[model samples]
Target: MIDHVYISVTNIDKSLTFYSSALKPLGWKVFGNYDSASGPEGVPDLYGIGDDMYGNGKAVGSSVWLRQRKVGETGLYLGIVCDTNELVDAAYAAAIKAGGTDEGKPADRTYFAHGYYAANVADFDGNRIEFVHKAWNPKRHV
Candidate 1:
């Protein structure tokens, strides 16, 4: 299990808006913010965005941190799970409207498995992000 993941972006504000919009359709929202100066020991300052009260009514700390840095070529790709195919489509649209570059349009990825709906987009800083909806377990939808 991962507690959190952080990525560096050229513009924090732009990346924040991009991510916030992209993930909103999946029921995620920006919930916390952190300043590097105020962050604990080795952690960098970041904008914490995600559904905090996801499981057991306790924060799982599963969030994306947007940190300021110089823009450069990166191979980082972040994958987020969506509960429904509709959410995947909405996320792709939101990402594009939020200034993301469309890498792959929403479609069924039968190679991955049956009912695997997904879309990919590059964030403001060119980080590839994917939204996927797998119909493996219907009970997991939230």
Candidate 2:
């Protein structure tokens, strides 16, 4: 399993707001943040959130970190797992409400699998992300 993922963002504050609000339903929280001074020289400011332990006011590197991007830089695509179809819809609605563009509405993505329910959205800077719940044979939801 992946330990963490970091993505470039145009604005730290805006990205933090968007991510913290949008991913709340998935049990993610803003565990830590740091200005450039918190790192080695020339490091950009960062904001992090995820489903991991938060102690000593730092994220412990088990989260998604948003950092300042280079001029004219772009983004990353992430597909997150969900437990149910309703969560896919909730996350989509929350993302849209937080100013994310609708890449795709929540629905069964038969194009991928028999019961691949998912929703897609893009962050303010076009980082495409999807929340999915795949219902498989024997009705397993993962």
Candidate 3:
């Protein structure tokens, strides 16, 4: 239902490096890039990192773009699915190593549903992201 999500970052270069390593375990990568001059009139430079099944890297299939942060915008929250509880831990570990702040540790989140294992971490720009593995979700993605 969603094409892409644009994340405004205080620094794209730093975010790119951080995310490239952080999301690798979940099968995401920086597949596209464009400079500020390459965008429409006033758009800042964008870096694409996510599951790029659609090939655009800026749209289609989990396209996540990181651009220059705008004033007065702190951040947003996002959830990323993991294939296993182990992957959830791995993602959390990687995120922390990549400079993410620990929001919560990996553990079973029965408060949400049975078999929901997850971890929470804040990105460079303070975006709270959850890495989750939920057996309660569709079988294909879990």
TM-score, model 2 to reference: 0.46
lDDT of model 3, residue 18: 93
Which 10 consecutive residues of model 3 have the lowest summed lDDT?
Answer: 52-61
Clashing pairs in 1: 36-45
Better of 2 and 3 by TM-score: 3
Please provide, for model 2 over 1-142, each residue's C-alpha lDDT reduced to its tens digit, 9 standing for 90 to 100.
2224568887888889999899888778997775666344544576778774323223222368798888886777576766679978998999999999988899886644477688888897778788876564122233
Query: Which of 1 and 3 is the better model by lDDT?
Result: 3
How large an RMSD does model 1 have? 11.9
Error of 2 at 73 (Å): 8.8
Q: Give candidates' CA RMSD values in order.
A: 11.9, 12.7, 12.4
Off by over 4 Å in 2: 1-73, 137-142
Candidate 1 global TM-score: 0.48
lDDT of 3: 0.72
Cα lDDT of model 1 overall? 0.70
Over 83-112, each residue of candidate 1 has an lDDT whose tens digit, in order, gives: 778988998999999999988899987654
Q: What is the clash tally of candidate 1?
A: 1
